[model samples]
Target: MATKDDVSQSARGLLKKVKQRYMKSADFNGLHISTIWNSREDLEAAAELVTARLVEVVGPSDYMNIHIRPWPTRRKVADQIRELRELSDDDYGVCLYPRAKALKRTKLPKKCEDAPFAKAMARGRSTLELAFFSADVLESYRNDARFRFGMGDFGINFWLSDEAFDGHQPEKDHVGLMHLGFAYDMRQYDPEVPNTPIVRRVAAFYGDLDDLTPEHQQRWASFQVGDDGIDPHPVWYASQMGHWPDGLGPFARLKPGAQSYQRLV
Candidate 1:
């Protein structure tokens, strides 16, 4: 039988190895540690080991959360993804995408007329518009049952395309070409009880800025609100000017009582 010290040492060694492997892989940037164990005791042990190692290696400032699940089904996975997306305070963060093809089909509305973006900007309406796949759809993978995987809390999913790492510079513009957003369900853990406090605490742990302070307000003036409860001068001006490549001079000339400038014609 293995002694307690032996088990502890073994767990620590495994965690160290895992962390080293992650650091060696260039593709694992911003990746978080997530694990699934065979038993509750094993899960807790692993969590403690992983958390301690991560804090020592990555620092205590890094935001980390351990998710424990008895048996995670497709619906359970989808629910978890949804919850994380809804609670995230970061400007950019992780979300779940069922699969590559499913991720590709996800898109924002093309036309501004009926789109949520247009409605939010023009009518001051804020609503969720993204389509989340049903659990039935998520479990459609051929090998999904063979392997058990866990995503970091509030982690994003990508289709793992060849173009993903192509020309991927840390400083330069590295746009995500293929991704899908998802949320998770924590209903089983807390049925009817709100997780607002937990979510806020996590946001604070991550140093995520949800609401702006007075100092931040002034600093972000160009990108923030204006006196008329609208966007700043440039943005408001652009909206009234339409989405044309040229300046607003052409559109302004069309207004009534405006000078018939030759250049506008």
Candidate 2:
């Protein structure tokens, strides 16, 4: 059995063929998304905790966009936190200042005139997310040298919207969406791309052709799985910055029998 759990012999054969076909069709040159935390529960807990914190500072909103990126030093991050704190008082601050281009095609609600950047953008659209950071959370990273040198763990994101997903691509309408990809000739390519186990299950199960709705059948027809391939940029940066925590590194311990699979084992 190629997978850990026993799959039927027929299913195994079908899965193998499917993977081969998918590889042929998938754009290996594309970028892939990965998570920083170990499990869904942890990720959710962190998000909820951040949401609570943000609510205390900025009034309720409908959405969030967490941004986790490298930082030069804690002082720099502290400086940014100070700026954000000042934004709360300055109604006409940069944080609330509207973008002329964003308002050109679509006029946002009058309420948006005084709302945060996140809420303003979501005035009319179905999805609106905002960038946020918590001083308390920053404290967690302050003492850790890894974060000080830029192996920072997390950031905060918030959003507000009155609409639910209607199955259209939000990326097409949204200006903030980012696409991370590598050229076909890049050296980071891996036959076994890194992904969470949950993603693996969804891909393995939905990937099969045993049953399909007519609409899905058409959608999968000639569908190019624009995948996000392995991104080692963080690891490379961590190593270059001289604080790649190995035994307890963010990307390490993903192998079998490690902490990530302890529950399954």
Candidate 3:
């Protein structure tokens, strides 16, 4: 009676359990990147459109550690946005610039503010992403907002490198990864915990990730992401900042639906 999709999901569920058992056994030593974006097609189109610009401004590099991720804003974080916006301009300039700018670009109906659904927020759509580990690939975007949204409905993807993911344990890698993600998602133990769908998916899927071969690890080192996550820009800042769109947000105004929040409805 099970459909192909159902069968596949069942198999994946079993695999996840097995992986969890492994995680409990070994120390995890590897880097894992969790990325969010709208869709694969949109990601490709956006990446292709900007590839030329990134090369022109940053110059071609043999390798760069860049991750294209959307702003982690959802209707759930409205209060966070308000709080960040309230901070002294100098204290919060990084979080407000893009959001207020993007709001100007969109013709949000007056009613959009009160519905409590994503449709009511300035950018309920999961279009813009942040957290490129290294900026050389798209450095120009650091200052200007207009240049970011040139590709309509653009989203980005991040790659995982085993080199960045090392620790004393291999079996425990997925467990640590899941814990880290959950810690980020928890946001100070706030029960609302937004983006449940996507977050859960990452936790479940991580159990199945394969260990990177040595050649792959060496290839990743070429990106030279020295001490990034420790005080990682974009990631650390975005996590602390709360809302999705702001100075860090690309000038994306279309405001597409958030992938994780959609499933709850």
Residue range 19-88, candidate 2, lDDT tens digits = 2322232210101111331233322322232222210111112012111111111223234334334333
Give the per-residue Cα lDDT of candidate 1 at 204: 9
Compared with the true structure, what per-residue lDDT tens digits does model 3 show for residues 73-175?
A: 3322334333322334233121111122222344444323332222212332222221122323223322333222122122222322344345333432222
Model 3 lowest lDDT segment of ten: 54-63
lDDT digits (tens) for residues 52-125 of candidate 1: 32211121112222111101122333333333333323323321111212112223222223322232211211
Q: In every candidate, how many clashes are there? A: 14, 12, 20
TM-score of each: 0.19, 0.17, 0.19
Estimate the overall C-alpha local distance difference test score of candidate 1: 0.27
In Å, residue 234's CA in model 2 sits off its true spot by 3.6
Cα displacement (Å) at residue 46, model 2: 42
lDDT of each: 0.27, 0.26, 0.25
- Considering TM-score, where higher is better, how would the candidates rank from best to worst? 3, 1, 2
Candidate with the greatest lDDT versus the true structure: 1
